[model samples]
Target: MAGKSGKAFDFSLFRRLITYTNPYRLTFYFVAFSAILLAALSIVNPYLLKQVIDKTITPKNGDLLVYYITLMLVFLVVDVISQFLFIYFANWLGQEVIRDIRVKLFKHMLGFKKQYYDKSAVGRLVTRAVSDIETIASIFSQGLFMIISDLLKMLAILGYMAYQSWELTLLVFAVLPLIVYATRVFQKKMKAAFEEVRTQVSNLNSFVQERITGMKIVQLFTREETEYANFKKINEKHKKGWIKTVWYNSIFFPIAEMASSIVIGLIVWYGGLKAAQVDGMTLGLVIEFIQLSQILFRPLRQIADKFNTLQMGMVAANRVFAVLDTQSVIEDNGEEELIHVKGDISFDNVRFSYIPGEEVLKGISLEVKSGDTVAIVGATGAGKSTIINLLSRFYEIDSGVIAIDHTDIKTIKLKSLRDHIAVVLQDVFLFADTILNNITLNNPNISQDKVEQAAREIGIHDFITSLPGGYNYNVKERGVMLSSGQRQLISFLRAYVSNPEILVLDEATSSIDSHSEQLIQDATDKITKDRTSIVIAHRLATIKNADKIIVMDQGTIVEQGSHNELLEITDGYYRNLYEVQFASATTTE
Candidate 1:
């Protein structure tokens, strides 16, 4: 799927797109029926013109002229109504298909492994889910239905022209091969151009999204000018991609217009000569052939432009389908239903690497009893956080087994397994919503009363009520309205409410004030009282009371013991780490 080539007018891709319309098959049928009616009715206007010229006007019969005009007016009404229905249903079908695809694409993305997101750009995904899908909508609204209607109209005009005079029709048909050749070349070139355009669009979206997300870093480093210069390069590339399409349009349309003019001229010259030489070939027949030539050649000229719409749509569809077709690396084959877990966790010689050939966690083994509180202390890049990530099954380990209650974690259903575990990271993310909504995460089963009671148990109830709106306060994006310590307290309350059998806190109070730290310490005791708790912390002072402390170096656990037991060792890793890491915090406190 990654190496697939883009082919212009891929029939397989077209067939796949058609299947999405099956849900709206009845509306689609109405659109088709309306297009057919419009095509058939359109020919009546030119036929009426020929009748007025040859039968009514030429003979000077006012009564017949009035009757023919009445018939033309009736056809006009029907044509207008048919056109309206064709436009309405075609667009409606397009909107509905895109809505379904967008929902499906988002749902698929939600199931992807964390590693997929590590390599994917947010803006690139946004373009696929939003911009690209909208472009596909045009394939039906402006491309497919319109092209079909035009082709039908052309066929109807060609039939009428042949009935009027076979020789004149043949003359017009001679120049068609030239127009067809031009269109085929135009489609090929435009498709390649459209593909470039979509790529550039994704690139531009990715760059802007990244810059905006990291605006704080940009401002802190004063790299505004440098970043703006880089953005201009991407913006220019996007511009150039569109320019290529414009250049192709400029070359193709004139050639088509010229070909159309030549056909019309040929009709006038050859038909005029034939009318002069023959008896039945009247001026009325010559004029009707000329009018019919415009109808036939006009669509031919416009088809090239319409094909551009279809081509752009195909390019967008190719991108969107590429994402939809991506199979998640994490396969959830486990059918084990875990109704309850004892929270006993064991790592048996687990080896893992985020990237190939670069091991982050080497062959490591550890165990925590159902009710034990274990603290993992390590320097940056020592694989402390990786342990938590692996335990939560955010990424699969390369080798060995991770078990909960002697049952392999891989054999347990992902949702059910994760349901019994809750994590609080150093950096907490809160959505722009009421604090109560953030705590419950909109889970209808967790009522406001339940959340308030949980907050009180966690000992943050007084702090929350002190805020202007209490638990109903709007946090704004990422909880910017709250202080760092307040946000940490909110996260603790959130995790506590879940009432998980296992709780993991990674540097939960590392960068907070003493007041917040004291509150978190009080809350942490309440939350981890009976549950299996894993605390990954850089601040050694925070974990002095942990039932067991494991000191990690590089990817291996070098020491494990109680705080007093580890302190008894004169030069052990935990003793040295406590002096180097916790001395400052202890003095500050």
Candidate 2:
């Protein structure tokens, strides 16, 4: 799928697009019906002109000439109405399809796991959602309508010409085969150019979004000039892409125009010579032939342009379908919900790795009894966070049996499993919304009183009250308006307010200063009174109160005991870690 040439149109993607069009089937039918009616009206106009020249004007019948003129006007009015109907439905269908596609794309994007985001760029995804969808919409409204209307008109003209004089029709149409051949050549180049232009535009959008989002970093480093230089490179690339497309279009229309002109010249010379015979062509017939030349060649050129747009739309459709087709690596099991959870957690011979042949968690055995606070400490990259991730089922373990209350977590529904637990990471994320919303994000059903109570318990209520709007104050993106200590305090409140049976704090207090850390630790001890708690922290002082401390190194547990037990043991990882911290604390003071 990645290496697909996209030279041939992807019929499957078109089929999917057409499925979305099914809801607007009646509108599409009306559009097609109106196109055919308009073509019939076109045929009637030329024939009416022929009649006025032969049966009315040539015979000096002034009354018949007036009647023909009146009839032509009526045909023109009907053609206008039919064209209006066609345009209305075509535009409506295009908008409707775009709306549906946007919803589906957004839903699919939301379902993607973190790994998908880790690999794919935010710019590339945004391009697929916005720019690609827009390009396809343009193709629908203009390109699709032109294809239908022109095809019908071309067919009507060709049938009328064949009936009038096959020889002359064939003679004039000598350039048509050339037109089709030329169109195919132009279509390939134009399609390639359009795809290149879309790609370049997508890159530019990504650059803009990244630059704007990171404007602070750029400004702080005084790298505005360098950033602008980088932006100019991408902007120039986009310009070159559009210029290439224009160059191809420039050649295409001129060649088509020249061919049409040559065909018209041939019609004038040859039609006149043929009219010298007794059964010669009528004046009306010559005029009709001239009109037919326009009817045929004009649509031929339009068809060429429509084909180019359709080809470009196909490229976008392929990309959109690629996103919809991606499978989520983790899914919930359809099992009974565990509403009443006992928070006893156990890992039976757990062995896991993110990549093959490089294990991050070795075979180990451990258990946390219900209503116990267990602390996990390790050197960097020692799989402390990996264990927490598995417990939460963010990623499936390669080989392990992780059970809560002796029930394997994989056997329980994902929603039920996650609902029973809560986590607060050191680096917390907050939306650009009120503090009230961020605290109650986990459970909106929770009352405002409860939110305030949780904040007060975490010792941040007084601080929030000091702000102008208190809980209603807006947090900037990522809670940037607040200090780091404040962000962690809010996150702690959010996690504690959930009141889950199991709580996991992944270095939750590591980012704060000594004053905030002490406040958070006091709250942590109170919150863990009757709940299952797992703490992953580097600071020994934070977890000294835990019932048990498991010290890890290189993906394997090396020491497990109470804080004092491990600290008293010689040559233990915990003892060495504690001594270093103790010495560092004295040195700092």
Among these predicted structures, which one has the highest TM-score? 1
Residue 223 in candidate 1, Cα distance off native in Å = 0.6
- Model 2, 143-235: lDDT tens digits are 777687888898988998999988779877798888888888887777677778777877888899888888999999999999999999999
Candidate 1 stretches with Cα past 4 Å from truth are 1-6, 276-280, 585-589
Please provide, for model 1 over 1-589, each residue's C-alpha lDDT reduced to its tens digit, 9 standing for 90 to 100.
2114555588788888889999999999989988888889877888888888888988899999999999999888888888888998999999999999999899899888888999899999999999999999999999999999999998988887778778988888898888889889888888888888999999999999999979999999999999999999999999999999999889988988888789889988987887788574777788888787788878888888988999888888888999999986566778887777788999999999999889988888999999899999988999999999998888999999999999898988888888899999999999999999999999898998999899888888998999999988999988989999999999998899888999999999989998999999999999999999999997787889999998888998889999999988989988887777667766878
Each prediction's Cα lDDT score?
0.89, 0.84
Clashing pairs for predicted structure model 2, backbone only? none
In model 2, how large is the Cα lDDT of residue 54? 90
Error of 1 at 549 (Å): 1.1
